[model samples]
Target: MARNPERRNALLDAAIEVLTDEGARGLTFRAVDARAGTPTGTASNYFADRDALLAQTATRVNERMVPDPEHVASLMAAEPSRELIVHLMRDLVRRMTAERSGYLAMLELRLEATRRPALREELNRTVREQYDGNLQFHLASGLPGDADAMRVLYLAMTGLLVEHFTLPEMLSDTPEALDELVAVTVERIFPAA
Candidate 1:
């Protein structure tokens, strides 16, 4: 395995692009090397095998999608109310949409997980951990939502993101429309505090 963390990150980022553009079937060491503009076999030097590459790529996608720490702190500083939930949801949507390739790569990972048990386990662990962390944060911050509300909000927001990414034409892509969607989702999920 390569000891250069930067080069390894570059390979993982390239893997993300390859996953987004070519889907899991086309994810290969050669493809990642080509995408990274590194010499042939470069990816192989860093990753043990395709499964290793795929698993690490899933981690990379989550890393790319992590929200800015300062932004999250600022949002948490505000009083926990339904409006605050709106702000948080909007921020999530913005981050996920802005990192479109990462999200698409994740979707590719989900499809690939259906066929690969190891990848499926990896994906499940990461996704569940993320959900638990978010739920914990919401509860600790005194956000006006129970676990059920959080669950419903998760489903609604995920549906919005999927529709936005997969069929942009189906939903109005305007910022105002998106903001409204987030606002409405929060209102419906949390009720008036």
Candidate 2:
């Protein structure tokens, strides 16, 4: 049975708020209900289980943060220049930093998914899609089509994001340091002439 659009949107919005403010572990049907200003039973009626609710929330968050593959491809195709690449990296960092709570909640969801095989499979699929999308961009950028290099770049970007939020002090207290770090990482992945 299909859910009412208004209720579904409300639930997703509430889930994002609850997950960001309270962490994924803190998410509960009652909390979502209160956040949505809907009846307590509404969440259960829609989600059926905690895992289902989390899966939906993860999908929602990804939809907002990660650009669609087609859009990324178009950007890559339009200008494969180093300047554009650096701009993309900086933009990504700024966005992730601004949404630290959501980023943390995503990390929590990944950890929890590891313990659940079904969730793990779904998470892995999503990751592969992201990887492919990134690889496509790199290929479009005239970079050497090295799968291993792309994988390394992807992992490094993920690590940098996690560290930026979880251990900002380690990177130093200056924006210059962050910019330098991004530049160095970009050069390593796509060396400048």
Candidate 3:
């Protein structure tokens, strides 16, 4: 089948929404087709099987959540500094907060990866790609942190994102408070000399 980019992307987006609502086991070609409001067999036509659909969905979720590279660069100062790190966190929190559903679907993908080796490998590679990119950016920018610090920062930011999205009431009630949390988290991850 000749794939139209728009249609294929729409189906993948709908798949994310389905995964977000139904979890890993609930995602199916038929479900995606139904959610996308497309004719039956549409999702199957685009993807070879369940695994392919899932791998693609995970990739799409990551792609959708990335903040603009230039925006990140602008905030990350040439020297490793708390301001740069806090700025970076602010951008990430804003993006993930706005795309709560996609992030939730990504969490679902994590559960699904545990049982499927192929899916696990795909998700690992996707995550590593993002990690490597951040490391590279940090290196080039002379950011104050080693690879290990970056990993810690990533995990801390992820935890904050999960809580902020899942039980928002449990988190800071105001945007400023959340930003303060982000600043504190980043500061802890990479303490000043």
Per-residue lDDT of 125 in model 2: 81
What are the lDDT scores of the predictions, listed in order? 0.92, 0.76, 0.87
Residue 4, candidate 2: alpha-carbon lDDT: 92
**Candidate 1, position 73, lDDT:** 96
Please give me the total number of clashing residue pairs in predicted model 2.
0
Q: TM-score of every model? A: 0.97, 0.84, 0.92
- Could you tell me how far off, in angstroms, the CA of residue 71 lies in candidate 1 after the best superposition? 1.5
For residues 4-111, write the lDDT of model 1, one tens digit per residue. Answer: 999999999999999999999999999999999999999999999999999999999999998888989988898888888999899998899899999999999999
Tell me which of candidates 1 and 3 scores higher on TM-score.
1
* Residue 40 C-alpha lDDT in model 1: 100
RMSD of each: 0.9, 2.7, 1.7
| Tens-digit lDDT track of model 3 for 1-193 | 6479899899999999999898888899899999999999999999999999999999999989888778766665345676777887898888887898899999999989999899999999999998898789777777688888888888888889888887877978889999999998988888877
Ten-residue segment with the worst summed lDDT in candidate 1? 167-176
Which has the higher TM-score value, candidate number 1 or candidate number 2?
Answer: 1
**Candidate 3 structure lDDT:** 0.87
